[model samples]
Target: MTMAQARGTTDGWPDGTFRNPVLPGFHPDPSVCRVGDDYYLVCSSFEYFPGVPIFHSRDLVHWEQIGNVLDRPGQLTLPPSTASSGGVYAPTLRHHDGRFWLIVTNCADGGGNLLVTAEDPAGPWSDPVRLPGVPGIDPDLTWDDEGDCWCTYAGIEQVRIDPRTGRTIGEPRRLWSGAPGAQAPEAPHLYRVGGYWYLLIAEGGTERGHAVSVARATAPGGPYEPCPANPVLTHRGTNRPIQNTGHADLVEAADGSWWLVLLGVRPGGGTPGWHVLGRETFLAPVTWVDGWPVVGGVEPVMAAPPWPARPTPQPPARDDFDAVGLHPRWVSVRSRPAESWSTTERPGWLTLRARGASMDERDVTFLGRRQQHPSCRVRTLVDPAGGRGGLVVRLDERHHHGVEVGDGEARVLVRIGSVLATVATRAVPAGPVRLRVDVLAPAPGDWHPGKEPDVLRFGVESADGTFDVLAELDGRYLSTEVAGGFTGRVIGMYAATGSVHFDWFDYQPEDGDGDPTPRDGGAI
Candidate 1:
């Protein structure tokens, strides 16, 4: 589909207050840059092919994913054995000298840190130039007044480098390590705001204690002074809805207004809340205070930017799989070999040739998109008669829940760590069947004692078009807290045996009123 057709329009908020997660669901470690009137952002994509999702926005509030930085197989090579959340780490996108430059770390296959350049943010990006000497993850690139390129990384270290060749000009030097007692100080970004060079870093780990700290220096490498306010932003010990806030990048609008794009999570359900959608991108206003930047609090609803709202088209809730290539939102585990999947094979349908026996195996042929909404419903028409396969909601291979069709039976499977079981099953007539998974928030009356983040219902749609829920699972099990990973839940299709053909897939997001937004094209 065309770019305009692929995106859905949204009504601008009348009250001038926008929602929290500007980019929702699994978009973590956000890095943003502005080029003229347009803004571009990139995020980390761990263990998933077509890494580093790139987006475009005019107001920074509404974003449309333009493309993936590493769309070609040669640009990103995530081995099948790559562990979950171990391939691509934090990526910093910057525009300097009439070219868009991206630097990031690939934790697998000894890739280390690398850089890629593209004339257009939505690109045919150049092959990665590996930085063999630059060590550590979350690498940030900046240029000084004299055109000297500086590389800052998670260890709070800096090194002079040549951008074109990825060669270090000097030895790496240690900079400020953030708060005195803070642990896991990482995600360092360097910026030249005005007279001084500002060094921003995330400390106190990326968990509940996550925070953003800043320090400024007269020179790129120098005796720096920390911001007296220290952590300019954090939700740690508060009753706020959003938590684990940090790893921020700053950008100045064309109107001279400053804004920050950072990652935060929204936990739900009972005590020790669980976050299923993963670290999402949140926008907060930034103002200069005493030559230091003061970041505004991140809330579920915050004041919009001063500029008139420029809302971009959101991705369609449903993908028909009619296009020759999969949409940018559709991603596969590890590597997605051309031989394993095809749209031309079945014309309008998406066909997957199973490489592994099940989702439990690392090499399984699975294609899915991030569970972007807190409450959403996913459905697909599958002709599993060719072999065993179905729809699945996954948080890594160990923690997942899904329904599969095979041998004249539709079964619901749950895998929580070591224990894997078929929780429910139903007999079905031969032919194509519709499988559905609904994640819904429990009503006030539904919360008896120990509540869950949400409720996940898995089943099949009957001929009458009514959904039959075979099993209801607690949404918390598919959350990052229970899964123990840097990623969140991804719901999609997979083949377990032979080949599985999916006619179409639908993802309907529900608003606070529990009403699902209209489908992408109205009806199937």
Candidate 2:
């Protein structure tokens, strides 16, 4: 975690701008909710699927997903995930009073937590009530301006809640107990304002003691208190290599300022733990001061803050997938079987029909996208016309990796979940097997190895040696913090519900100047 403290601060300010995970790839545990300049966010997609995506911002730094609240498959509970387990975890996008809700915790199967609505947050949302006896695992829902509505998860023996309506809630008192002080207590989040009732949570857990505390209690159950900076948004003692940082969510900005979306990365490298570019989406600049809430002002650096001036139309990163479904920022690891791939039967081409070749570890069907560059180049035209569709970067199903196509036989599979070591067979390029992969990193003062390799000290060592760094950028790059699941990034086209279907899927990302080049893959 050293290279002069992992470096990460945008320098002189202004290029693509600066700051903590302000929405990078595979966004995690974020939950913003503003509504005047219009903001709306949602994250935590565990087993991935079209679950809880829905983004849309006006100026909180260019975001635009706009749909996906469990897009199908009975509204979700997607199993078959490994890197960890099945779909939906830590979601809470509220609009309240007039309606907008979303409150999830579908850790897989209705063990509890689930509610949906839509006064429109770009959603048609509904279907998914199940809430009865809920307990923990990132829930969040606070109302009180007088409207009442509390619900913050992670149990000790219930924890403080009172929902009782949108499907039932109420009865939770276990109070505090977190940090290495363990005992669940994860991602709670509640915030009432002046009279106080903070709660907040995310205590010393997520990884390397992530921490983001607060306790306050005026009612809503509590003996609460803490927050004297009790591990506020931690690094344990600032050795800084960006290990975990507690799941969080709190938004104000529309003028009132206040921001803190949470989730950080840079653990090991090349494919371990965070899997480069995954646990993304960050931003901290909350300063309520005298009444609490204060971050990134006294220490804890990370940079990239100055993106607000004309962003309501930054769309067109190019997607000719033509849309009919999939795009609320697209996500999929489970819940995808309609035969796994299709497009209204195909029109201009985006037919990735690989019903069953390899989706990573515990059974996958990737449509992935979220490695965001330290060196990017992912060309794909595949026609697994001989079998097994291609092009992936998954980080689960054991520790996935990719580059495939199998019509006339061409491969490069790397699986680590159920272990596929590295296949490497090639031959399908007689026509359009295209395939191009790139992951370069290591450039700052240049020593060659990943200067910020999360904390493995260096990088590269994967025939199963187990070091796990995956993402740690801004110094010599290396960006890949993907995390067990809870999705984001979702690139386009797929097929193999049981067979082939890559008539076309041109993913683009290649400006590569490290040398030895051959650029011109399609789709912007």
Candidate 3:
């Protein structure tokens, strides 16, 4: 049986459970399509490879990572700066004429949105084709029963396209402007359910004022009328803590239940509210009441997850450095200067050779995904013959936490608002010492519970010195709510400046819990 067959049925979310965005932590601008009872969804990658992450869902609740839509350079390239928040934006995933299609905007070069598709999710995808003259952000496609396809985008414009050639079929038209059009409406999607064809859009830029609005009309091309309900979704009453709730893609479950997935950011930690893993993905329950869409725990239902228990289980996010290569989830924030990071160079460890002495704040590989979960401890064995290595929580080059074993001393870098201040440091013999980090994850519904404040800490254990707390992290001051980025917290390791190599890194999710593959390769 296939991955979808593993699940029994697809429908009826636990009313309130689908709250916020469905896919959380670093996945953003989601577009999902249903083929039979199986669901396939994709998200924009900006600078990360696998430009569009494709996921599979059966019940619309449980989701699995099927593969990436753009798997090769021929399809997409690793960007230097997709935009502080750009790169690949608003991707529309669809199935047309028996083939899979995904079109997106590559912002690194300010290139136009391009299209790529494959016979299967894990693809040898086709080369990207630049769209014909449509500009701005967020592009989506709608297919009618006649097999006619219409492309809707951020512009006040719509274009008909040839399903077979992936080219324009007719003159593009500037259709309807939503909510007086002043909302700077973007990320528009067109779909037909009943007698009414619905046009859903995101307006008010990507910040606290963001909203999901809708309109309806009799034809694909409109003189569309705004839904009677007006702004279907808003973050009005909620403070800036949950600010900026826009960019949405809606879907109908196999059981005819309606759901919408959008991109949202939670700013609560670090300076400027970090986007450690980048833009987070959210899903909200939506319903049509008198031809309008209502969002966020609409009456009988609760708010959606930044989309939730999709069709698949979260894949194994943990990895043992003992493996030959870095895990698939690992990404360098900026372009990697060198690929000398080879496991063969240092046996029994995934070694990352340090490069440029200082890196740009927005992009750095060391500033990896925020491990997502809270209360996790990561420890690594460093065979520092003469250089440096350590474990860290990286948001970018500027904001990061790590206990480094270098310069004959172990020091913890406390990142505070674009500055790295050595919070704690100690002298040790230092050659081949082990550095361990324990990051405290925030508990649900407990933002400021002091007894259990979401803080981070690090320690250095060595033959020369016993394990000692290098720094006691105070996280009450920061959160996704404060360090504003589009994603959740992820943690990893780093090597800086020169080519220093790292040894075994053991990530223990939930502090003190034994790591399944704790470093066995004793430190030199």
Whole-model Cα lDDT per candidate?
A: 0.88, 0.57, 0.63
lDDT per residue for candidate 1 within 1-524, as digits (tens), equals: 11222122355544667777888899999999999999999999999988999999988888989999999889998887799989999999999999999999999887699999999888999999999989999999999999999999988899999999989987899998998889988999888887999999999988899999999999999678999998999989997989999999999999999999999999887878889999999999999988999988898777888877778877888888889988888899988999999999889999999998999988899999999877788999999865999999998989989999988889999998999999899998668999999887654344434568787888999767798888888878888888887998889999999888999999987655142322121100
**Clashes in candidate 1: how many?**
0
Ranking by lDDT: 1, 3, 2
Write candidate 2's Cα lDDT for 1-524 as tens digits: 22212222223333444434446666777888887778888887776677777778665555767778778776775666323545577788878668888888876664568778888877677787766666656777777666667676775233333443554444566777754455346777777777987777776556555677777878756777777766667765554546567677777776676878788664433223233566776676778777888876322244444443444443344455666555555566665676656656665445554544456434455676555433454454555554566665555554545555555655555544344654445444544555545444333333323333321111122224432222211221222343344443344334443445444444443343132232222110
Give per-residue CA lDDT, model 3, range 368-481, as digits (tens).
443643356666666656656567765443445677777788887767566667778898774667777655544444333233234666778765645577676755423444
The candidate with the higher TM-score, 2 or 3, is 3
TM-score of 2: 0.35
The model with the greatest lDDT is: 1
The total number of steric clashes, by the backbone 3 Å criterion, in model 2 comes to: 51
lDDT of 1 at 132: 91
